[model samples]
Target: MELRQLQYFVKVAKKQHMTQAAEELRVAQSAVSRQIRHLEEELGVRLFVQKGRNLQLTPAGSLFLSRAEHILTDLERAVGEVREFLDPEAGEIRVGFPHSVSVSILPAFISCFKKEHPNVKFRLKQGTYTSLIRDVTEGEIDLAIISPCPETHELVKGEVMLTEELLAVLPPNHALAGCKSIRLEQLKEEPFVMFGEQYSLRPIVMNACLKAGFVPKIEFEGDETDTIRGLVAAGMGVSLLPELALRYSTHIEPCVVKVDPKVTRTVGIIRRRDEKLPPVTELFGRFLMEFQPSADPGRPMDRLDGA
Candidate 1:
């Protein structure tokens, strides 16, 4: 089948509405429908089945959709690489960052990179570590900044950008609030305010607690760090949070204590392992790893290691 047919099918599959897909593609609804039908005929399998007003992908359609999306993404990347090779400085890079990184180095990294490569445009996505890795694996984003580098497929490569200390957060009036440092086991009985299960921090904290010999009693689970910190400040629970999160907060009700064993989260850059990145993306990735935010020069920035 032609590339155009695959493109139309992917759009329709994503939107699940012929008219919506057509509008997104800037083509007529009839044309989209006809091309999708032709694609199905060419594949000798039904790709979509109508369910009320929405178009649903059949089992065969679901399988084909994944392949079609990968093909389209690869084609786009190939074209981008060629264009960027010719003009080196003029290409878009899709970069993803988890909430913690976004609050810390993201602003400085972007501002510094922009001053250096003014023509390079960035499309940024803020997501959880899990979502960032999924997007990178699916080719939806070129690179991501994530914490506690993940176990990835052979196709993914990563390098440590920096490591940040994970501190225990509690209400200012808590018994241990005045302490300079606390061990993981000491907070075993404390009710924890934690990010949702999808966040990479949750697993890190849980594993640390498990090693310390107790499962944490989670009193609240939320999506945002600031919200969770607020809960802690209100005495709802205690939490383990990255030190960078404190830098962005104006609220002073929560007291942060260094962990005795000094828990740390390693933040890193992840990209496709074997694929050559576009010029702008490659340059941006390097810039990010080397960027030392002057505001926190005391924190250690790690060197890049092969994924």
Candidate 2:
């Protein structure tokens, strides 16, 4: 019921011995025992059982233990949230990003942001686009680097960080690889490698194919860009991947071609509107919006990477 009671219960559940729990809590053993008794009495169930000095939890205690731990964790998070609002520069921000972004340009951006705002702390979470959108919409994360925006009900502020055309990856000896220019339709009959369903790229690739006048028959699927590139190198299937994805491919080769140029995705920062973003997040958000992929980062990338 009370927070102290929940904390006491958690410690007791872990230590299992009243004397040890009390010592760890820096309280008298009687106090520890009394608190547990009071909690059990209030809940109308026994929380712990004793037969000699060793302590054990009852069935009821075990169930309560799980719920109690969750409650305490949530309570602590709630406290941190308030602190973040009151003093953002000295508080923490929850940031979510796809693993690819985390590897390519995000880590350096985080390092730069941290150098500028050392007191600001980060709690980084990684997931597919669907999961990242859900976290941002549900208020679990303070900010996120999301791409090819997902369907959402939460209010968001987004800005395009950079835009790069989707390019085709092929084996070194593929016929199309020799062409100075290739159309999406040229590779229509070729087997296509794709990102898994959970990724933001899957829909983008499919829709691009649809617009280009054919539905691709997928040959291989994976979440990793490197793996996708590897598959393309092995002649499994060619893939329509963002320029950033190709940044990881050492074995895989990209054919420089001209296309419609309209097919692209913007990777940017997002936050829920109902909650205020901490100062740390705002600073990071600014940095992300200004960041551009190193190859041709039209804006932020140009500024930061000196391209």
Candidate 3:
């Protein structure tokens, strides 16, 4: 099928309205209909079904839509790589990051980079590690900062930036609050507040607890690291979070305790393995490679007041 046909199909699938899709595509309504029909015929599957006056994607259409979007995104990246090769200093860099890294790492990096390359722009997408990885693989983002990289196919490349230790956070009144360090086994019966299962840190916490001989009793889950810390401070449950995440909890700071086994997560940069990175993305990656966390003592998390 033609690339234009796939583009038309994706727009139609997203809008689910022929006239609206055509208007957005800046084409005549009949052209959108004709292209979609041709795509369906080539694939030997009906892409859309009529329900009253509105259009909806059929099961086959839904599946095709994902592939169509991926193809278009890859095509856009291919064009971007060529354009950036010609104009190395100008272009937008799309980056994905989780909340923990956003609070601690991104602000300083962006500030320093902007001073050197004022024309470079950034489009930031904040999400869990899993979503960030998906976005990188799907070509939605040029690079991502994620922790504890998961096993993947040859389509993704990861370069470790640093391994940061995690600390146990407990309510001020909890028995473990006074301890300098506690073991995973000590939290066996304690109610736990944790990142949502979709995040990479959730699995790391669970596996660490499991290795210590008991499953953690997760009592609450949240998408933001600060919210989870708030729950801990409210005496809802205890949790293990990256030290950087602790900076966001200053308002209702939980007592931070070191973990006995010294749990740590590898924070790193990731990009598509087979794709050629744009000039701006490559430069940012090099900056990340040369970054030294210890050199930046101004990071809020470094205070560790409640530890």
Candidate 4:
């Protein structure tokens, strides 16, 4: 019923322990218990039931917890917005991104943005493609750098910033490692190392292989770009990765070969379509639209010996 009561209830729901929740809230355990009791009486439903020493949310309790959390989050954002509006240049921006872009694209953009607006702060959250998009839609993050950006979504809007090629990465000593370009069909007999199903890249690579007339034999699955590259470098299996991911790092250098069919993914930023962004977030969004990565003549083919 009261803001403090909702806060106490949500914290208790999360911790599932009265003492621990009170400890976290820096309040007396009896005060927490009193607030929880008042909240349940106002709602006319038991929010939590005891199991052993821990508490479990009853059905109604679970529902109310969700609403309470949303309300608290909105209130917090409203307060932050008012503070940010007073001095947009010194505000904070929460941005989400996937690991694939973490190597170069994201750090570069942030570095450049900081040079001009050094007082502005950033809170970065790295997640899978799907999770990043979900965070933006749910208000957990203000903006996200997503790959193979969605064409349309009900809750979010995407803007394509750059389109980069996805190339085949082979072990340095593999038979095809020296080739200028390799066709997808040529790797049909070889085992592949690939990103897990959660990654957007997996489906893109799978469809590309499927179109080339074969289902790749996946030998290993990993979440990190560097891990996949290391697997390929050690002859665990070959993989297809974005060019930017391969270009910026020298660790466990694999033989980078161009995909003959030219697979590529669009890198873009997404934000909630319904919400008017905070002043700092809006400025960053505009910068993203106009920003471009500097050109490097270095191609995957250059990684091969005697090219």
Residue runs of model 3 more than 4 Å from their true location after superposition: 1-9, 30-51, 55-71, 295-297, 300-307
Task: Tell me the lDDT of candidate 1.
Answer: 0.85
Q: After superposition, how far is residue 154 of candidate 1 from its true place, in Å?
A: 3.0
- Per-residue lDDT of 41-129 in model 4, one digit per residue for the tens? 88888999999999999999999888999999999999899999998889999999999988767776787688889999999999999
Top candidate on TM-score is: 4
Residue 207 Cα positional deviation in candidate 3, in Å, after optimal superposition: 2.1
Query: Which pairs clash (backbone N, Cα, C closer than 3 Å) in model 3?
Result: none
Q: Pick the candidate with the highest lDDT.
A: 4
Better of 1 and 2 by TM-score: 1
TM-score against native, each model: 0.84, 0.74, 0.82, 0.90
Clashes of 1: 0
Which of the predicted structures, 1 or 4, would earn the higher TM-score when compared with the native? 4
For model 1, the stretches where C-alpha displacement exceeds 4 angstroms are: 12-23, 29-64, 293-307
Candidate 3, residues 96-171, lDDT tens digits: the string is: 9988889887886787778788888899999787788889987778899888865455778998887888899999
Q: Count the backbone clashes (under 3 Å) in each candidate.
A: 0, 2, 0, 0
lDDT of 4 at 28: 100
Write down the lDDT that model 2 would get.
Answer: 0.75
**Residue range 1-307, candidate 1, lDDT tens digits:** 7999999999999999999999999999999989988988888999999999999999999999888888988888888899999998889989999887876678767776777789988899998877888888878899999887755567678898777788999898999999998888999989999999888899888988888889999989988878888899999999999887776655546998988777788888999788778888988888877754344444423223411
